[model samples]
Target: MNQRVLSGSDLAERARRAIPGGVNSGQRSIPGLTDLVITEADGARFRDADGREYVDYHAAFGPPLLGHNDPDVSAAVAEAGRTVDLCGVGVTTAEVELAEALVELVPSVEKVLLTSTGSEATFHALRVARAATGRRLVVKFQGCYHGWHDAVSLNVISAPERVGARDPISAGILPEVLEATLVLRFNDAEGVRAAFAEYGRDIAAVIVEPVPHNVGCLLPEREFLRTLRDECTRAGSVLIFDEVISGFRHDLGGWQAISGITPDLTTMGKAIANGYPVGALGGRADLMELFSSRPGGSVFFAGTYNGHPAVVAAALATLRKIRTEPVHEHVFRLGDRIRTGLSEVFAGLGLPAVVTGYGSVFVAYFMTGPARTYDDLLRNDASMFVGYRRRLLGHGVFELPLNLKRSHVSYAHTETDVDRLLEAAAAAARAQLADGDVLADVADASTMGGVADRC
Candidate 1:
């Protein structure tokens, strides 16, 4: 592989003049990297602006489950573009077909409402819950990121001390918006019971990620999940499973199918379209009908690009491929292999870290044991993990910039890629251990902004 002599820093400098923070998303900007500009991606690898190729585990923040630029999905999008570019006035056949596919595949989805992004899906789902239950408060577990909407955006990455407090991560979020949201510790059945006991009647919905990946992949205990379902049913509140990241990636029916705990409303995106900008809100027909543009019902759900032809076609192709192929099997096998290999590598290096996740998504926590809640994750040596991630990047393993974000294995990934990742992890661990004062060095690096602060 010949490297091209392109300058990523030069391109980033130019982008900073035009865009805020020189990136479209805040997480794209790494602390120590000169430039994080990706030029091309195919299968399991992506090429940077400098023409450096690396095995990508970021998966474009969990969208490219089939890997970037999959041939079938691209071909479907191209064919749809030739037929119809945009039909804003009327619904297209592609949209109709995609909705049918979603209804057939997802367990709780009886009626599907299309949206342009995950944020829109979550926002509308919350609204529908509010309308159905006639309540204003929403209960969200801490560390589970539904999206960047005002209602779900609060307390995403709050400090350990602010677990139950309504602390908004970003500025400009109104206090009233934060008040509507009740942040609870994940896997805390007692806390959930207490919240419902205090404000059960006023709660519109209880939204959760069945397998929370936002704060490094914490799986819910069976008791905790059942408690949410029981509590919501008792309180007449809608249970919204924000499966934006876990949907279709774990199974055809999402994690709900595996758990047999179907939510009243399900918000799905990311892997649903295999990198296309698409989202869906679906659940019990009675609840979903709140968003209907019919005579009596009114929820006000509208988006111009809700089901753009090309995007729908891409989603259709991706879903059909997953249905017929061994996609889940391949991803699961790779995930197990990677986890085992990484565990062995860390144990051999005498590093106190644990790999946590389910199915194809995983994260390396610089802690001795598994984390059950957001505060438990805060106990991790995040600075040390950031240094480890940077070292892996140097060795051609491109993980997401955030230390706590989950890394995914796409169907395109192979055993060879897993081996390469293990090799890089071993090398990185050796380099970190070479210094006697590694913890002190990591603490110093933490002072530099843009290092393991954001979720």
Candidate 2:
């Protein structure tokens, strides 16, 4: 552990005594306790309790596109708090403002339903789909994570034996629930078609991450997205694009605008509120009509914190900045610079890497070429990635802690930030390449290996 990061060691120690994993979120808890204890964050930098600062490429796990604590969003939240922050039984102006802004910002969305987190938004979306279509089955692709709800959590990560098959990754999710989920390989149009042909009539919805970013930032085939839209419409089932990570990231309208396809339902979170706990499900009017139907017909979606006014104000402010201002374009331009810099660094090191992204979001994958599916990402050498992460952290560059996910750049990052990140990356890559070679030699020497089990 770095001595500079030790100021929060006591805080973590106390947290472990109460929380299950010494942290509220799994991703927040670094695997080896190497992360700084973030005391405060503003713009593209976060400070530890000991006052150590680093360039934050994770961007609070792909939110804060306007950077942390943007004055407009914070002021909006603060002003709204002076009136009312939550209205469990009544609607507030903040909610209406947010809904209006979202509808205006996202092209395919006509109506909006708000929630506190991505998981709740997805759960409500699934329930709304089932109620609207009069079906029980939900189809999802492998490695597309739509939060932790039981219905969409299947096939998130499979064991090697279950790699190419559909299997639930957790217990307590009944077999019947798993039975209702049809999982297929991502980017495989034929598999998608076959599943629809067999069970489309019973499927309530086809839910997916337009960009499958859970395992890695794997882009969907253009034709596959179009086919999904066509099939869901033809089958009379709702199509859900879970754009929690992709919404307002690549473009203002999300991957839908980029892919030129429209879904019946779209779930967005993460970046919408710029790190505030807010999420939304929005789309076609007829599909959303299920939520307000008759007593027996209406999908029973209720939450104490759904459309919390403070968060709504933040989201409204954030979306307005993206739409009315040049923040999104700035983020895109900076994202290009970062990606180009990463490509040059990786290529110069003779490392197989590809930096792929559209606007603020991108991934530096250590592979020979682009990864189009979760299956392809599964084939990547994660050990090499872990080594790279460790080396980068040592050099004062804070990237996403997971090899399964990559870092993000925000509008707050400057050209100087990009240069510093590239320098850190080049140094990390070189050191990791040497470590990788040494590990390969050690593996060759050991006689007792069938496979290395890494979780």
Candidate 3:
């Protein structure tokens, strides 16, 4: 028998026949940036199946905080493979150790529960809130994305027509579930107040992404977050900070540490495991005890793969490195470099754009002024956003071309990498802005048409 070496395009074609839209996640099916089959990832770069290398600012949508294939995390996972696999009945020691760390580090987490994905963490958090308070309503900001759960999978990156309306991002969700969720604008303190005034007693939780990273980083207004705390406290509604993206990426304590505002519950994932699949929900011990497995329990919370040994080991290693090493200091410096560099690039070219983000995350918006809400981001040129990102791929920088998406910086990146990105950005912006095409001239993505092998 002869071995078959498949091209990236050939693999993508094979996937399209099997997977919906040739991708597992909707965001991966980019119009001009799909078809890459990643063969390897290490440090700050990734290589496509065909061996084309690119500096990876995509960072697997902000999961690779320590950078792709971090040595510490990889080694831990390898060791775990030799030790334990899965025993669903009992919890793993690694899980207990991770929970202890979460409680110690995250300001609001007195106790914690492990899960396999961000979505599951969020779903469980909302359930806890509803069960604890006996309320039916959940208040979610428009631009923030907690997860794909029915209550949240709406209004994110919504079309202009759907703004300010109860628009479900997906159909088939029970109408009552949509009604239970009150959609409000990010940084809209008045909206929070009004919602509380109308349905305070019925609202179970006010879920937010302290920094709305999903729509390219709409930094939260301190007053708005404070207002949420005050309203939720007065109404006895649980305040849930969905820190899936901003959790371990920002600080060991999550954004709650830097913000100086505590939530009743916190959901964390993404960088917690340095790209390993693990999520955690943590909060006051009194509330977390509502899980079916606990004393005086009622709410059901179970996952067959929760706290799988290898991923738990990865999380433990990632946390230990964050505690002992200069991970945050390094990545923060690089984040500032990229954001400032991008700002300078656009300003020098006399282009109107806004660059915004907190530590280790940056988004270059193709519009004038700042973006603190979904409404402000709508002013951005969606076409130019996609086209500029597409052009950068030609320069060997991997940024997903989806509009309102942010680029990440990791400890693996260097000042030289920032310089290269700026140089690439200058060239891409000059050509893209001058041509003024509706992304018509953007370079083609990989030679394939389906899924990207992002490992």
Candidate 4:
């Protein structure tokens, strides 16, 4: 461990006694990062319990797009807290306004339902799909994570042995649930067409991440996204865009707005409320209508905090900022700056690396060039990737020191922030390339990507 990051060592030790693996989430427990307990996050930087300041590229796994503790969002939340409280009966004014904003912004959403987490949004979306179509099977792609529900939790971050196998990331998942999900490869248009051809009638929905951020980033080909949309439409099965990662981060209207391919349903979260606990499911009115509180309605929807007033206020404030400010433009420019900067640094060092990102997120795969699929990512130098990120952490840059995880830039980041991050990353790369022995010490947990298995 670096001597600079040791201030949190005492708190980390105490946390291990209280929480399993010393953190609340699997991603938080990523080896080197577990020791860091972030005490304050504001704008583009956060401070660990050690009182060490670092530019935040992790961004709480792709939230805080407007930056942590934005004054507007925080004020909105505070006002909502003072004015209103949860009733668990009918909708709040903030909820209705937020829904209307989502409908206006998101191309595919005619009606919207709010949930507390992306996982719940996806779960309810599938339930509605099944109820509307009376089908048992759902289709998802390899490495495209649509949250941790039984239906779509299979075949994400699969190891080499389980690439083509029925690789459920968790053990307690029901066999029937795994069997119902037909996992296909991302960008494999033929595979998608074939799945629809064979199981069209039985398929309830086909959910996909327009950009598969789970395995770093698999930029969807136009043909692949069109195929999923077309096949699902032809088969009369629902097409779901699980844009939990891509939703409000890439565009105000989401990736669907950028690609011009809309799905029957969409799941949104993470950047939607910029770090607030807000998740939404929305789509064609006819399909969304299937969920009801009435006894006869096929899909049931109930949540005590579905659209908590404060959460909706935060979301509304975030949407307001994106709609009015140059958020996407700034983030995209800085994202490009960092990506190009890292690529040039790696090039100058004569390292084999492929730099990739979409909009505000970026990744450095220490292996082949132009990776498009999980199979390609399997070739990345796991040791080198982990080691480089660990070195960056030591140099005051914070990315999860793990393989195939992407870093994000927020609206609060400035040109100077980008420049500093580039310098730290270049140093990390040079240090790793020069001293192979240094990499053997990036903590013991090397499991690639999964929920419970990361630490």
Candidate 5:
């Protein structure tokens, strides 16, 4: 093998001596491709340990909306580091300022609670819902990921046959925990209605990703979102929109602003701090007041780095830049270009595929028809998609290895970047088609058991 590839392999071997899977995250380890050990990143690209560069579409799992090493965010973090790195005893002014910015930007957020990670935010959001409603059950849609917490981790990427079953993707989660969570199909209003009818009185919260991106960016039908709102309202269940991936990528107020439907609580991370470690849970003043320590009952929510000065400073800078600049316009334009260009490439090649997503996020599925729900997404050929992704990696594009994971576009990407991506994609498609009748095989393949095989 090449010395550069050998270097990455050696690093992986060394990591495995200490880490569990030779990678901190299981999803980072691509099966066929060499493990990428990134040394540095700037703008829309990142360099591997071998000094080879690739246009980065992973964006550190959708956090670097402003792209890597943004000057403004870096400067703010540096200033905070020089002044106050950690003040665990009391709250800082920067934290208050960031909270104010969040409250102003998000429509449903009258109050904000800072957490260290998205998992913590979602975990606390469920807690708040339970505390407010005095109920035990939580309803979540299939393929909507709300962090790795046990409460919201069930049915993230389940088998097609296990659609309505509350199956935990990760081990060590108690079966009782899964029992408390009711999993339903995404964009299926009738399924939701049936689930609510069965468990409406016991449902404490119904959490959803307004734009379900985990299973390849399946957008919510208008009536579907409205149904969730109406059901949650009538059932007295807290409506929680897990906007960790969608927040600020499309608009300031998230999909809530675009859809004109408000949730009772919202969880945000990723783009909020532009790659910094931060998470926020915000919602109506009355509901958020459950976390207050001043008077009545309070849910136990606290973290050592809850409002770290440096992290808050980074968030404040990111939000301010997003507010003043044309970041959304730039990313949205490029996203549309890529989405449209890829669809055209597939059509020209006579490949069975479709692209679906919104704003700066997109996913290419190896199926012809529309992908509206989790079951529909399962019909795509995972093996062919994985092979295509591997070929794209070789062609100098970096995307997540997961079959239907979302690919992102950052503010740093330009029209030239989109052109380059489409060129590489077209080449990848042609190359994949050259290897026998792959398109025919994809079109004829069964979707049911393939999903189970993936797990």
Candidate 6:
């Protein structure tokens, strides 16, 4: 593999002038780009701009469940690209096949609507929910991000000071958009019930991540999921499960399958198309009917690349690979191995860190206790965990630099890859402990400023 000729910093400087924030996405902009510029990836490793080889846990930010440049998907995409440049507005055989496959595999979804990104799927889901229920308010949990859309982006992660109160994280989001959305605590049944009691009549939908991975892979209580289903039904509020990060990572059907509760609407992305830019929204027939574009309902949804043949081909191939090869079981076993290794490594160092996750995704929280809610995450030593991310990169393991956020273990990761991660993690922990200062002391307390220069 060939590395970029320019250093990471020089490349970033060049990119910043051409692109926003010196990166294409928010997560791609780490503290500094001086050391990282990905050129090529194969199996579990990525070659940086400097041609440094790294065992990658980034996994293209959680879409490469089948690994980067998977032969099956690449071949499928290539064949499809040769057949058609763009499907455009017309129907295609590939789109129908992909939708049919999704309907057959995912128990709750009867129909599917495709989009170019996770944001579009979520945005459409909210529109469907509002149209179906004829209500105005939408409920979401704090710290669980659906997308950058105005409706889904409100108070995604309130700072520690705004723990119990609602506060929008971004500016230019209309006050009306924030008011229309009701932000609540994650994993709280009482809060759900109380909100329903107060705003049930006006509530259009309750969208929740079945496993809540955006805030450090927080697991939902079984009863809480049941409560969401029952309460939404009783109150005539549509239930939506946002499975952007969890879809096909654990079970092929997603977290909702393990929860045993059906939602009115479901949004899926990330792992759906094996790293291609695609997403899907689907569920009950009655609610999906509102999107028919017939005379009556006005929930118009359209995208230029909604059912792109190249992306659809990739998705079909990825789904087929998951079914035939059955990578989920292997990834689960490997996930357990890595989690246990991190736990043991932290325990040996006498650090109060915990490795928590489900399926192939996990997070290392530098707190004494579990992170059940955003408040719990705020109390955790985020600075220390981020420092660990930086040190691990120096040792050739590339996980996200943010602490208490999503970490990945892809199908390409071997037992040796897990060993390398645990080794780097142990070393990172030792480095943090030797510094003697807690992450809270070492880090700036403000939320608006940029992260310190690292890596």
Model 1 residue runs over 4 Å out of place are 1-6, 436-455
| lDDT per residue (tens digit) for residues 1-455 in model 3 | 99988888888888899998787776676775457777888999999877789999988888888888899899999999998889787787888898889999999999999999989999999999999999898999887887777888777777788898987767699988888888998898988899899999899999999998888888888999999999999999999999999998999999999999999999999899989888889999899999986855999988888899998999999999989999999999988888988999999999899998898999998889868789998898776777888888889998877777788999899989999999999999998898867575442331111221222
Q: Write the per-residue lDDT of candidate 2 for residues 312-374, one digit (tens) a residue.
A: 888888888887888877888888888898899988988888678767777776777658876
Pairs that collide, model 3: none
Q: Can you rank all candidates by lDDT, best first?
A: 4, 3, 1, 5, 6, 2
lDDT of 2 at 265: 85
Give me the overall lDDT of model 4.
Answer: 0.87
Per-residue lDDT of model 5, residues 1-455, tens digit only: 66544577688778778888676654655555435677889999999877778898978778889999999999999999988878677678898899989999999999999998888888989998999999999988888888777887777777777777777767899888888988888898998889889899999999998987777688889999999999999999999998988888888898999999999999998898998889999999888888853356488878988988878988999988998999998999899988999999999999989898899998899897778888887788776676676567777887765577779999999888888889989987788768734433432232211111111
- lDDT, each prediction: 0.83, 0.77, 0.86, 0.87, 0.83, 0.81
**Clashing pairs for predicted structure model 5, backbone only:** none
By lDDT, the best candidate is 4
Q: Which stretches of candidate 4 lie over 4 Å from their true place?
A: 1-7, 294-296, 441-444, 452-455
Candidate 1 vs 3: which has more TM-score: 3
- Give per-residue CA lDDT, model 4, range 1-455, as digits (tens): 66754468888889999998887776777755667788998999999887789888988888799999999999999999999999998778888899999999999999999999998998999999998999999888888887777887788877789898889877798898788888888999999988888889899999898998978888989999999888988999999998889999998889999999999999999998989998999999888877885446668899988999988999999999998999999999999988899999999999999999988999998887768878888888888888888888777888877677888999999999988898998898889888866666553355456642211
Look at candidate 3 and tell me the lDDT of residue 241.
95
Off by over 4 Å in 5: 1-6, 292-296, 436-455
Ranking by TM-score: 4, 3, 1, 6, 5, 2
> What is the number of backbone collisions in each predicted candidate, taken in the order shown?
0, 0, 0, 0, 0, 1
What is the C-alpha lDDT profile of model 6 across 364-420, one tens digit per residue?
888787668777777666678777777787898988666456688888889999988
Which stretches of candidate 6 lie above 4 Å from their native place? 1-4, 292-297, 436-455
Residue 202 of model 3: what lDDT?
95
- The TM-score of predicted model 6 comes to 0.94
